[model samples]
Target: MSRDITAVFRPDPSSPNNNTFTNITPNSGYCQPIPANCNESGRRFSSFRLPIIFRSTAAIQAGHVDPRQGAMYQVPASWRAVQVANARTGETATLEIRWAGMGSQYNLYTSAVELVGGGVTPHVAHQRLWGGSEWINAPAPCRDGRLGHFNNTIYTFFWHTSAEGTCAKRASYQIPDLYFPFLDFGYELRTPDPLMMSSGQYTGSLTYTVGPGQDVDMGDVLLPNDSAITLHFNLDVDHTLKVDVPPGGNRVELAPQEGWQAWLNSGQKPTRLFRDQRFHISASSRFKMALECQAISGDTCAIFDAGTGHAVSVDVSVSLPNGITDPAGQPVSRRRLLRDGSGTELFQAGSFVDRGMGTLHFEVGRERLAEMLDNGGNRYTGNVTVIWDSEV
Candidate 1:
């Protein structure tokens, strides 16, 4: 059987602390990753649920699938790798996941079954590894993690394991044929950084056999209704590329860096006319930037004087915040933005940048400034649009 599993990630402004994906996949029972249960495996492991149930090959009236005697399992606990490709870009990333904990519901054949340490009718307790002090409360069969919420038809138990080997737990009574109508599980995922991945759905599939001497092994007697299960994963990323321009910030006037003071005081000729337009940006995805200009000179945007018919090349460059980087993984510092979209194809984020300050430099160079100065008493004006697109 094939099942779908999904997770989503988007930049959160208020909670702009770390980068992580939230699992939106539905689960059976309370089979999520609990803090106490994941302490041993560190913070890298998570969990999910599977819709699967095991049935007995033959019905046993009153017996237990004892650990030392019969019950054996080899869960898909070790890391399994899969390649996920973006739905748009065709770029692939590796996604690794493993089963950390497995829980199930064992249905009761009859209501009068006896539990080892459970006195109540619907017994709920941790599975004992052996008969002595080797029970729950000590080092459990989950050698690397701990047990979480437990539930079955008659007896409720939880289990976790990190080591790559077979793990077994006996039934106080028969672990009912109708167990795991839905299996609660925990898993550790080694996913590619969302910052490095393109903005789209990255999809992949992982399938495991469910039988004796297989991935979800239930040993010799207890058989599963399904022979195999395919878990189809869809990890979607919704990127944020918001640019907030200050009020009246659209009109840019360029007239030398230190203003026209040098020319006004000593009759000195200014080298360049420039203005730094500041903007605040919040971005969490790969984006490309380009300029759309009303007037263009060569490959750069230009400002034109309608009366004098004089057009001067206005060079535009950008400087992003600390967390943003250019295509070469260097911090974006005065990177040139051309009309042809050359040096700004893919500006990536090293971290989530929320309302980070950036600069747009508009400059009339020495040559261009000289032409504008030569044609005196003329106002230069033109519209320039800077486009930041997230569909890169």
Candidate 2:
């Protein structure tokens, strides 16, 4: 019974220790056993921090990501310089996202991508997820009230991820050209009238926006900041002219032969012949009318002597209404006479503004008839001709 017994658990100095141990330290004043790395663990507990990173893909030649500002992105001029030549329908320009750290750890959280401010229209926007072998269509997200609108459109795409490791997502934004309706003179350019006049050179502009859906400080990614493009074109018009003579009052009736003979024998003056006429004209340019004479006998008015065969000359005069103008607005003379075979100008128009309906009063008179009767009472006849001319 003799010696006091002591119990202790200790590892042998040469033996390999495999058992686990815990420090059963008391909260108040009692001596406690500390672990080997206690100070290191305490320091780490006070200074622990997690990193978050968002970045553009290596394939992106022109755009950059700002990790400090909520991963905001921009494409400067150098990036914009990369041109898309005649981008086709269904063709797309990709904006990719590469993320690591805590930001990429959302197992069920949803993120959205959007486009705004560009002339592009009727385009398709969607997201793709990385499958083991290929990209697969991800479930598109419904519209979220938080995103609001962009470029007057609510175009948005939502995506979800379940993996917590590094993830890469992409938005394929279809680049489709925009078109506008154009009209001239109430007619489309496709079926324009051939006779329509030209409106000359024309210039116009179109505005557009293209960017992410969120209303952030970042500008449009695919277009200029101004978002306005100029349109230049010219309207071509053709020149045209139309001329017509109205009927029903266009004929002139000369005095009867007996009446003229009685007047010649009695020394009474012959009655002058008169006619009222109208001409309809439509033109886009200047125009005119020329007159000439064709003599069947010796002159426009000549009597052939049956016995001596001597020709007797008679004078004829033609007159039109004074103050009358042609479609071109030029004044037409009231009187003109046939001289030689070359025709003389009877009417003229100077401007397109002056073209339209016109009227003319014609009067024909004969002189030196008594001289024709004295040369042996022979009959004579001639013809008068008129021509209309225009710039086209």
Candidate 3:
């Protein structure tokens, strides 16, 4: 969207008849001759003018031009706020604002043209007007100005000097001395949360002001204007899931007992497998998790006596604490290792919740180790596979 704030320069009201005001029409074309009325010798004044052009960075990159052609150059405008809806909550999501284009500098100048001049005389003074606390003369060629940030918004104003010199040797000039006629800026929004954001339309607005520099405000002669720019954002959520276990590995060792009674009297205990298991999941909608386990080798869990050629199959069960839960305070029930079937659900949450980090506690138990010893057990090793699944 583009907004035009035209500036009219006229003689001060105290001396209204001293010099006639001339209105310069802003457009996309090259420089034109100054109005004949601006040639009076008396001190003339110019009112500040600012035209703001707002557009998305994408549109600017695509070379979208303003239909009005108010400014010679076209640039993208920065955003004030970008909102996204959390996938789980379907409401406004947390975000961080990042601005771009502040401190970017651009040159303001009039079109260069050759004027009729005798071989011994210069046609027009080579000069440029620059922006400062007030308008000031700059080295010929062009003047530089930068976009500034304040109160969460970007602002800039322009200064103007009427064209000067004889008709036969007229100088091309910028009506509003220094302005951001073709300035472009933009920003990006980001979040660290794991919850995905919904894909949809979002809207916002930014307010800014334009006026003369500090030195140019002669007793309110140069008034400022406040304007609002609307903003829009379309967000999309990405489904993500991750699970990790300790690096060293989950292992348990059992020593053979002298007899069944001795093994029973020893009071064998289940060893804790992994210190902690971690999982992160995000989805555009609702999600659930399940866990399953199976013996790595043959159908039965067993250990063999190499010398006696005998094997003892043992039942291994995994125990978990029923109190495990997610960041959102949703509980995950205790689950037992399953050799078959669909497995057990760990936890489930609706679209309104976001689960950050999840932890799992596991205990490996050897049932009836003494009974296995009676069958002539030897040193044995086996593997179990644990699977974690997430569905959206």
Candidate 4:
């Protein structure tokens, strides 16, 4: 049987408003999310109860699960990698998952029900292994078979170290063909950056062999019903890309710096004419920019003089917020916009930038200024369309 793991990432209105995935899968009815571990480690975890069971035809000596103590484990406690692909876009990303912790509604059956309540205390069993420090831990009955009724649980926490990890216990008495009916497991996932990933569902699976010297080793004493168990992963990302402008922001008026008072009074020649129109943007994905001008020039847009039949090219550029950057990871500042969409094809955000201020620059050089000034009564006007596309 294969377990299902689901995670989703979206812009949250909570503290540390990061673009990190949230584990939507509930615990296998065993382990829960611990605030200290999750906060310190920057990783998301979820739980699942696998249908695989460990049945013992023969008795297991006390120390097989752990070389040192009498420990029992259900997971391999090692890293495994899988490649997830978006079904629609054919885009692929690598996902790494490992057994972070484990537990179960174990059926650690006793030979008789009369011996179910007076075994080792939970603290005594807890002290046998290297645990009691993770999400959940329930010690199995050790001394008395009656102990199984109190806390017939076998929980363990895993570590990323090379030494590997196992929980502890030891039986001073016999458990009579000890059988564990199901496996409850916790998994930690490492995924690619959601900002760079396209919005969609990505799917993949990984199966592990569960037996002696296998991925989910239970030693020679225990045998699992399913030789291999698969875990199916589903990663969903919901992103946001929005642009907003103010009431008077639509109509742009480009004029020489300090206005035309000097040119009108003393006939002073103006060096250049420009205007900076501000806008707000909130983004959580990578985007590209392009332009569609009503009056097209060689490299930029042009404003046409209706009366004099004169047209002047106005240079257009953009300045994005601090977090958003170019393909080369440099802050965008007055980067020229073109009809070809070059250089602005891959703007990425470092985080979820909410309502960040950006600017669109419109300018005419001194060379182009002479033509417009020559016609004193002429007014140049043209429509410039700026396109922000997330298709890239």
lDDT of 3 by residue, 190-293 (tens): 43232322233222333333322221111112132323333333333333333444454355444432323544687643322223344443322223433333
Cα lDDT of model 2 by residue, 1-392, tens digit: 01111111122223212111111212110001222211222321000011211222222211234222122222111111111111222221111111100111111112212232233232222221111111122222211111112222222211222222212332232222211111000000111221221212112221112233321112222221322212222222233456666664334333443456766688765554344455665544333454444433343444344555655343443333333354444454443433442233424322332234555444434544445545564444444444555421
Top TM-score: which candidate number? 1
> Model 3 off-target regions past 4 Å?
1-181, 186-192, 195-261, 264-290, 295-383, 388-392
Q: State every prediction's TM-score relative to the real structure.
A: 0.80, 0.32, 0.31, 0.78
* Deviating ranges (above 4 Å) for candidate 2: 1-242, 246-267, 271-285, 296-373, 376-378
Q: Is candidate 1 or candidate 2 better by TM-score?
A: 1
After aligning candidate 3 to the native by TM-score, how far in Å is the CA of 246 from where it should be? 7.6
lDDT score, candidate 3: 0.30
Q: In candidate 4, what are the lDDT values of residues 30-124, reduced to their tens digit?
A: 34444343321565455566777777667545334443223355355567789989999898988788776555433345422322334555534
Looking at candidate 1, the ten consecutive residues that score lowest on lDDT are: 129-138
Q: What ranking of all candidate models by TM-score puts the best one first?
A: 1, 4, 2, 3
Tell me, by lDDT, which candidate is best: 1
RMSD of each: 4.8, 34.5, 20.1, 5.7
Residue 388, candidate 4: how far off, in angstroms?
1.7
* Cα lDDT, all candidates: 0.71, 0.28, 0.30, 0.69
